[model samples]
Target chain A: EERPPPRGLTAPTVAAGAIAKKWLAEHFGVKIRGYMSQLGPIVIPFQSWDEVENNPFYAPNADVVPELEAYMDALRKDGDSIGARIEVIAENVPAGLGEPIYARIDAEIAYAMMGLNAVKGVEIGAGFESVSQRGSEHGDALTPDGFESNHAGGILGGISTGQNIEVSLAIKPTSSIRIKRPSINQAGEPVEVQTLGRHDPCVGIRATPIAESLLAIVIMDQLLRQRAQCGSDWLETKEQE
Target chain B: EERPPPRGLTAPTVAAGAIAKKWLAEHFGVKIRGYMSQLGPIVIPFQSWDEVENNPFYAPNADVVPELEAYMDALRKDGDSIGARIEVIAENVPAGLGEPIYARIDAEIAYAMMGLNAVKGVEIGAGFESVSQRGSEHGDALTPDGFESNHAGGILGGISTGQNIEVSLAIKPTSSIRIKRPSINQAGEPVEVQTLGRHDPCVGIRATPIAESLLAIVIMDQLLRQRAQCGSDWLETKEQE
Candidate 1:
């Protein structure tokens, strides 16, 4: 929404939780990571995971890592904060975790992301851009590369295509800004509001860890839900017989 | 996906199935409808339910109703077909029908819509455009009129906001075009292929009934799933005591 609710940074809790759940995923060989791709106008293109881990912004671009401090100082001076686009990528996620027509992999991911504070939009691979694409250019042609492209975003017909699944979310600018803005009070009277407290200049900067935590929760939840509903293993055993 | 498997319009069956299920939903006063909002280049803007029912496209706008024919004729001349964007609106739905984080109303709706043939994208309310929106402008203010805007698409924190649920899907152009195209056969050799059959120029033109049926299935599934997962009525009754 235009304004997320004013609150202290819940970033610490999200990070702590993610750290705990990460171990569970590691046991299963599922790896998940999140990184900042955009901070207002400063875009740090995706590179390698090693570089993203080393950077202060959790961005793959080394150049933008050093520039984040100066940008935050400027943002603080203006009583404003920058928004962000953060991406979460999951590798080695098993196929068929989601159910069709309701609990698809991408759909569940979108739900998890949209539930986060300040998240205004969510998209799977090649999402909104697909609006302008033609069939030939957009279709994923098969080659020795196990399908020449990933235009399908690792999921087809609601099931994982055994490719790395990527999800992106657009986080709105932090609402708890030092700047004054118009708002209606509890009784619906117009008033000017300026939030007070030490707040993160770009909350998106802290979003990576939180996004990973949510992704882990969704994956695990879907795994259990599918078992409860369909007993996928039972069907497999029956087929083998 | 750019190419949904070629098949005849299954509109009649979808409509009949929905009619059969409508009785069950009637028990709860829930009503759902799907309509075309965009056909190739012709756009029928959402207006009112009364007028949408009167139009052949099931679109809210009466203005574009008569213009669909010319666009399809123009599409056929080039051996190409158009795509579509359709919307499904569900009214009188009870609140708290979906689960948090993984099975939110909007997320489930997106999953259902994306499962349809030729569907490439899904959005709820203001969706992707929310990427560019300011928090102040995007936040729906509470008024006696319910909500001043629908930017959130009638769901909040993964629960129903007790308003009309709106979902939209982008359907890719039909892949079975008469125009010849280069492709690989089963043996991986290059060949020119041309499809011959009766095809709807835009499959989305017939997606309204299918979408409605799918939406019905999702709602019913959620209802039963919720009941199965937790005895909702018993818990509520116990709380009252």
Candidate 2:
């Protein structure tokens, strides 16, 4: 479909990964979902998965419905470029799945997400915020009813805490905007150029599926690693190769 | 070395890897350094390699002389639990050293760091701070001065941009604190027990060298990956493998 994406203006070629993720999720029994938490400077309050499913903008909630329409109107009015911050959730990841220190869960997740074309940042739960916290404040206290807090973002000592894995990624503004900008060509002479190609206004708008796919890939890799490190119990159904 | 570590007590097993790292760095141009950035609530600002060399508290810097002495005195006085934040720097990393998505550099680094015991969080350069910055502010502008800024922490789209790679790791307090704490034995008996074993007070005290070693392993893995992906021009003197 050549039409503007129902979620955002990203090229369909990129967003197309969602279809594959949908199929993989069914086979894996892992639910992966992503939604825009922020668009440009327009921030949206977080919504549960139930609420996120209905958003036409593919945002996590309807909290920004009016703001979204107004922003879209303003974009059309002033022809400005925008960016998005996407949050992805991966549920049902088994604990004891990641390798320690060298092949870790958080490290793997960060690597996968940052590898995306426009992702400028990746945070697991309260990632960077923890830098400002004290050791006592940041450490998750354990209780009989599970962890009192998930400040560790479902990961502890680099292994899955059996809590849902949450990752937020920052997708930078598309550099392919039509605005004319100065650049040096191959011979190094400065020239003003306007980009022309398949582009997305905010590529993150359509990135949910892609995020899911990447998470799936990481999860799958970890699953195999878990089998190798922890034993092959999870791979009981696998045909001997 | 048989004595309990002055900070978070730890087994000496981890610190042994640094000896090998020192030898490895001599052969390769890449040099890895790690030291305590935070001890409990005390924060030591980043220091240059020259300043960091003479620290007695395992910091790379001699800058925290007064603070280090006072902190050590207090640790000896109260004998309370504490943790450390370690920052590891990898210098002279070649660009394009990581896979675009699946086998990314940041992911590899994070995995290596997080896999270590007691590491609570990991950051790359201005890691989590970018969460609040604007797109215009966060995006590193291209210049003849290379990347102009390394807010991306030497990685872009999962590949090294030929910058010094910086990693910050938050190491949790050692679990074997001398404090009398409550825990359930395997028989489900609630018991107040004191851990008796060889332990460091703050495991991070000895971790600088260990962190250095882990970083070495990751760099070597990525270096081999780089050679495999980009071929042997980078490894001009490799023995047949």
Candidate 3:
């Protein structure tokens, strides 16, 4: 969103959000979306941002809403918090957008996610699950048509592989609980600390927008770097190839 | 070392290298050093830069030189390559020099190290070794005098802990080997690929200076960031405290 200009001044024009999305689709045929995969202990089964926007405690199955509400109520009563998982996907991301050996797209995504508040872990594609998978199963099979799978999370050897980019983040429970916690003071003496004032019992409930913003920032950064290193026609040349 | 100015032009003077070292010692009591921990497969047993400067293949024990020479000869004959490890240490780094959650000192260092050519892995303090150790053994014990050990590598919770920062890097074998390999052509046809021209048999042999330079860069960046966020008198105030 663009901020309003001062009374006597005109703000610089820039495309952002829906406008940027439309521009990208028209120019590069790229589409990006962010959604929650899990809220606390419940897993989301459907892709519906409208449902989530309508209700912060939105669950795919209508029957699960009451159960989630009850669980949240219990957590609030006990002065506790819960964790969540989020996923962001970019369809038709341009290949070779990443700088390999260091500033890889996956590495940049990890850095951005970890920088977010309460983010404890990050995964691309199969991630930790690949540890249990065999090489034959883990590697995406290449075909004349396209890749048979997306286990690499749209990246291969630190570069985009022309598949949908899938990134997941593990957000830890909010720490500012009402319950008293034992901690050491500046003087190294024992202290009982209790949080006061407004606090989020589950910070991840409102983290979708922040996560999406981070992805946008990283993508923009990569685009600038790519243009600087590969020239302005890099994307057009790649598309032709 | 400062760059010499052009004829009839005065250059802005800034402390660097030995002068910077002297200045830091005089003002803040900080000492930084970078050295090779291993050359190829040789693990250095002594800290000696003079010895390394005299000979890039300098091994702690003189008896191992002939064996290492033989190994290098074999690699050259086979048109293969080997790897090496390097370490850099900064003593008495002021506490709280790093930004938390995002621009952590360790994360920045990792980024810098990974950006180096042929570097495949990075470690801080105990690093991967801690994976096999129990929590009790891995965590550094705090005492009245100071930390019993520095397993955290001078950083905890993304902030500097005032301990010596210890970083190690794993340099992979040079990819530009003389040996021929199979590869795909632009038309997706099979072909044999062979590298020609001057190439280092071991890129890591020349990586010491580069690694040291990167550490200096990251440290200087952190210092600037710390000053900007915590005020120009941050280091002075930290020292006084």
Candidate 4:
């Protein structure tokens, strides 16, 4: 959604990603879900977000809420912070989306994820774990039916493999902590710094929705790039293939 | 270097990067150099390509030619291939070039280098080596004179620090080797393939100039981006600061 600037004003502000996601979901049957994969040392086993609205934790597992709360309580008591991991999956993504080399879907995903506040690392599917795997153990087997696995994370050689696109992010602890620590000044002098402001002990609590939105934006961008490079019938041709 | 497509053609063909580099050099005095850092196991000690055209090796060291020839001869004899490493540096790059998050200068460099043929990995400054380094060891110290070091590779927080921007690439062996290899055809049938066309045993030999062009293109791109986002006088303001 966009609105013209008021009289004498120069520009209009818009939530472009949110608007685009809404438009895409309305036009295409794309479905995306982002959820906390881990909080501090706790691994959350939420497979879906069906009950996210019903719980303050925004996860399916209500049982894990106590553990998460306790963890947050301990962090607050110690005037400390913790990190988190989040996962996002996009389903019904067009198979022919993404470009080679510079604009690979996975590369774009990493760029987008790392751009997010506090994100330090990003991975696609097996990611770093695949480094230890033999080819036999890592390469997904393609069958006449469909892909037998998604170890390539829905991408191969910088192109989409027509599977569900998956991504994970490692977010660093919130930097504006209550704990006093060593720091620096603009003059390159050593200083002690302690952030004193209303801050979330764990910013990851709000990242799930934001991550979903970001993934949507990246997919939309890739879709636009593919359309520009291959024309509108590209999807139709890919479907026939 | 752009030519209007003859007569009935609607578009023009152009060597855009070459033209851009020439224009930037003429207008802004940006200087760039790219050279082979290593070929296979041979580490090239060439600091510059001053005598690149005087020798068939395109390197400053004439003595290394025999070793390079020997390595290529051995590869040709075995019908095998080997990888290469290249380094590109841009000097007089204005400080404050690049964008945050998705379009970090280093990220853009990685994206551009990865887009190049056969490039498997990219590193900025100390790059992967920093993985093993502590913060004190990896971070470049800022001083009144300038950065005490450049371990950040001329960039900090996604912006240029006006230092010489350095980038390195790990290029895989050229895939079109003479050796017969097992592969699959479009019909999903097993096949043995051997390339027949005249091919360079080491593609990196020709990559130096191209990589220079690529880095120039990336810098020019970031310059344009900075201008668009921060206004045309952004560089002047940054220099004032």
For every model shown, what is its TM-score relative to the native structure? Answer: 0.69, 0.72, 0.56, 0.59
- Ranking the candidates on TM-score from highest down gives 2, 1, 4, 3
Candidate 1 lDDT tens digits, A1-241: 2355454335654765476467536544678888888877777777777888786688887767767778778878877766788888787766666655556676667655666766656666665554444444455555433556766666766677667777877776665666676666688776667776677767787788888887777776766676577797843442343
Q: Which residue pairs collide in model 1, if any?
A: A2-B134, A2-B135, A2-B136, A2-B139, A3-B135
Q: What TM-score does chain B get in every candidate?
A: 0.83, 0.82, 0.81, 0.84
Quality of model 1 by C-alpha lDDT: 0.67
Error of 2 at A224 (Å): 5.7
| Ranking 1 against 3 by TM-score, winner | 1
lDDT of 4 by residue, B1-241 (tens): 2233223101111255677677657656778777776777787787546755665556666668788788778878766666677778887788877766557776666555645544444556765444233333444555555666776677765678788888776555554566665555678766666665666666667666667777787788888777788886875564444
Our model 2 lands, by Cα RMSD against the true structure, at 6.4
What's the lDDT for all of these models?
0.67, 0.64, 0.62, 0.65
Q: State the weakest 10-residue window (summed lDDT) of model 2 chain B.
A: B1-10
Instruction: For residues A155-187, write the lDDT of model 2, one tens digit per residue.
Output: 765578777788877666554445554544676
Where does candidate 3 stray beyond 4 Å? A1-94, A100-241, B1-26, B39-54, B57-63, B238-241
lDDT of 2 by residue, B1-241 (tens): 1345333213342454454455446646677777678777778876666666676556655767688678656654444456677788887766677766566777777666655666655667666454344434555555443556667778766688778888877666655544555544566566555654555556677667767777777777777666787678656653221
lDDT tens per residue, model 3, A1-241: 1233212101111223445455455556777677667766576676555565556653334545676678778878877666677777778777776866658776676656655545544556765444233333444555545667887778655677789988776665655666665555677666656665566667676666666656655666677688788887986675554
**Model 2, docking class:** incorrect
